[model samples]
Target: MATGADRTAFGPMVIVAADQHEARPLIDDPWARRLLPASGRLAAALTKYRPIRRALIAPTEKKIPGLWASMLCRKRYVDDALRAALDEGGIEAVVILGAGFDTRACRLPALAKIPVYEVDLPANIDRKRTALTKALGRVPANLTQVPVDFNTENLADALARHGYLPGRTFFVWEAVTQYLTEDGVRRTFDFLATAAAGSRLVFTFVRKDFLDGTRLYGAEAAYTEFVRKRPLWRFGLAPDRVEAFLAEYGWHEREQAGPEEFTARYLRPAGRDLPVSEIERSVLAEFTG
Candidate 1:
């Protein structure tokens, strides 16, 4: 059976679809059209495949019926916030760590002129490239995929080969932290500290309460599914502890928000129907180094 990175790889495809669903829709596209039989289009492309649809997605949603919708809305909220943060900092370079078929580099027009480096497990990178190539007939010029195993590789060395400049780069580290060991998470922060000043990070972390049974909307379902998943949640910080924690790593907190805050901020004001139980919180911080 596929365990570890192999199993974890499929998680992002779902995230990508949720992303397309919650974010701006295409000019005239159905949900299935948004997702299927194409790459570089939207997350919907992955959904088009029968094997993946049945194997990876079916079981997860079955475990928690509305969880898929919530995940999508969660992406909607976080991505919107990350875009604003990066834009404000001037996205000279974009590096998506643990990038799992995320199409942000192509989806956001402002990034067209900017170079994008997507770092992920090699297996997933190969899969993404193949799918995207099939979808677009070729990979987009602005996007560069740097395949690396975050557990063993030096992010700096890998990015350096791709012409990554540490200065003022915008980083997206969403939905990645909890899967990493504490050491692994620190290694990433260590790399960020090495980047040019004004470098910013946008990331999500599991909240402490969720693990303690103190929070979790569909508590039983959420906990059960997480346990069932191959890459289990290994780390989370108390909501109040994030700023101080990042400060120790030379990251100055710019924004910290819970799911409720994001829903009200990103969804409700826009008249979106997606509802997210404010479980995980996203934080935006800048590198002091």
Candidate 2:
């Protein structure tokens, strides 16, 4: 049985899928197309896992709105850019923070040659293992599942135990900072900074203004309502402040992608008009330690 803590930790997978399902159609990037099937599968699994959540978990009757939001949100660009960066850096190992039913390890052939580490709660790891076992016959050899509670376990120590070298690693943390407190986010970044000298981190953060209660209610009322019931609410950070925050710890920003630019490069060609409501309006940042 999953403990209460474990349940809370793993529950976000369902929520993320619910969020993606609600925003996928508007996303015109090839990466979104790759993710849609996995997202849809996970959404269905979540609904089957809990009958009560089925109705709420289902995709909205209209799909275009969701796609519109995804394109505007630019998460797909963040993911793609991170992968490209890792490839360019000749990174041999990849760590995915808070991975939730994400199928990149299995689907991305270029990544098949590299070792992929997925860090999440034990329950989620177990669920992923079971699901992948049934779907793929077995977990891929290049993929390593590391289970840990970020609140209690030291990330550096956990990664060390799992054979992650302090040097020569790339970390991908997407759409998770908003769920962490300011202090928690700082601590995690601090840990990564000290973990390895040449390590790189790819992460995203929502702009603080976007999370203001009044603005959230006015612009993303539905999402605001959905997140309100969760223990972890969105906590946005200012884009300008991000550089200063990292500079203090000897980390340097290498590249950045905003929502609008991301959509233009990855989705606009698909002829989609992204809605403001579904967009994440976040900055995707890459930093080197």
Candidate with the greatest TM-score versus the true structure? 1
Compute each candidate's TM-score over C-alphas. 0.79, 0.73
Number of backbone-clashing residue pairs for each candidate, in the order shown: 3, 4
Off by over 4 Å in 2: 1-68, 71-75, 195-198, 220-231, 276-288
lDDT of 2 by residue, 1-289 (tens): 2223343333333333443433333322222222334555455345434453446433431421343344234445555655776667767688988675666687577788888999887877887787777767888899988987665567888878988775566777766676666676777777776745566676766566656653442345444543455535456766677778777666777656664565576547655454333324444444444
lDDT of each: 0.68, 0.59
Candidate 1: regions farther than 4 A off = 1-5, 8-66, 85-89, 212-216, 228-231
lDDT of 2 at 131: 74
The top-ranked prediction according to lDDT is 1
lDDT of candidate model 1 versus the reference: 0.68
Clashes of 1: 3
